[model samples]
Target: MANISMTETVLQCHPMSEKGFVDAIAVHVDRAEGGRLQIKYTLHGLVDGIDFPEVAQPKRTDELWKDTCFELFCGRADDRSYVEFNFAPSGQWAAYAFTGYREGMTELACAPPQIKCTAGEGIFEMTVTVDLPESLRALDVMAGFSAVIADKHGRTAYWALAHPPGKADFHHKDCFALQLEARSAA
Candidate 1:
């Protein structure tokens, strides 16, 4: 395996949502020689005010975005198909594949991701490592990192690497601003 490097990025909250107690959300992403993709999200804010469900056994679940959740979207730079992954602080996750922008959604089946989270004082952090689908490993990939944050006061904010003109649509290609070099066997 080659030495993997991580790219750091800061997410911006959508203008439509009020940026309450959250100061900033930062993400670190990297891919290994094979298909392993690792991402870490560090949120700086009034951590206690963020709604967090009790952590349970890690499992594949749906609709994690209803609360505070972290997300990743990735696809081949030359193709329209993409994958969306949702990671919740509660150890539950969901993955779906799309034929195109928000089209043909289907449950994705792959190895389960390893997720870990910790919060203290004013910081909340989560790390997720998963195996990328083989189809995406041989080509350069584009990715979008986003999050849905809900505070104790019932305020919800959408954060992403970039936002489209109309609304906070993570599915829009504009959000896939990060380019990740391909990892193929030499």
Candidate 2:
């Protein structure tokens, strides 16, 4: 078995009625073998209980419409970090990587794949833009893009993607940029 370690940085935007912005940075270390992947992430700048489950829950509101809207927009409460993807060993990629968020509610706005690795440079950079609905914005939606890099022999060299605490105003039709770098296991 081979071990590949990576450093990741993430930025995200949280649109809250009360808190105008919630942005943060996260560092990640990942391990992959036999088509299965495991990741451990540490986040900085997160407010108390800002994970998905806590954010997705509904609060009591005087207005009935407000309460109902929250339920419809945000799904079940979840607290884990949504930052891992597993590619099938058959070499087929999933239409979407991660699951848990509402379907069609969040989408990959822009992802341009630039696959070029220079000699002695283990970094391959790609950019992906995630567009999230207003309700899902509080999930810090920008950290959902991640991929595993494999060599010609189908060995995972590294896993890379941007972490959360992304730029604010992510819902303003602006594109969020993500960079991925793959280093050799030499």
Candidate 3:
């Protein structure tokens, strides 16, 4: 393959529930050749109070979604299949594959994701890069980026691209906010 050309997308996810804890959440996604994707999240709000889970060993762990974490969903537009990646500030990650909406979920065999995190007075930023699984490497793909934030008082909020009418379902088709096209070789 030729040198991969990268494209960046910036997305602002609105809170699906409580909105008071956050002023804004920005998600940036960059895709390049060979299905390498990088996602960055910046949160501005009362960051100090939130509970960010930390693992003793800083390894991949399930249920990162329960606390403050960033998420990414990617799949072929028509396949009804996708992989969900979760990143936590505590240097933990999780990857899961699904056949359909909330169905046939299984742990995805993926290499460890590269994650970096930093925090300021009222801001927090995190970035993660992962290689898409062979099954999801396609000429075109759809993506949904989201987050779950927990406040100091243990109140949780959901943020997503386009929330479903009834609830916050990032896996829902409506939430696939971005489409990525394969880059041509130079």
**Which candidate comes out best when scored by TM-score?**
1
The weakest ten consecutive residues by lDDT in model 3 span 7-16
TM-score quality measure for candidate 3: 0.89
Per-residue lDDT for 1-186 in model 1, tens only?
Answer: 475657999999999987768999999988777768899999999898998877888899998989999999999878999999999998999999999989999999888888999888999999999877878876678999999999999999999999999878999999998988866544
Model 3, 62-121: lDDT tens per residue? 998888888888888878888898888888889999999889999999888888888899
- Output candidate 3 Cα RMSD: 2.2
Q: Each model's C-alpha lDDT? A: 0.89, 0.25, 0.79
Pitting candidate 2 against candidate 3, the one with the higher TM-score is 3
Provide TM-scores for the models. Answer: 0.96, 0.28, 0.89
Between candidates 1 and 2, the TM-score winner: 1
Model 1 weakest lDDT span, ten residues long: 177-186
Candidate 1 stretches with Cα past 4 Å from truth are 184-186
- Model 3 Cα shift for residue 18 (angstroms): 1.5
Clashing pairs in 1: none
Choose the strongest candidate by lDDT.
Answer: 1
Per-residue lDDT of model 2, residues 106-174, tens digit only: 232322211111111222122221222223333323333222222233222111232234432211212
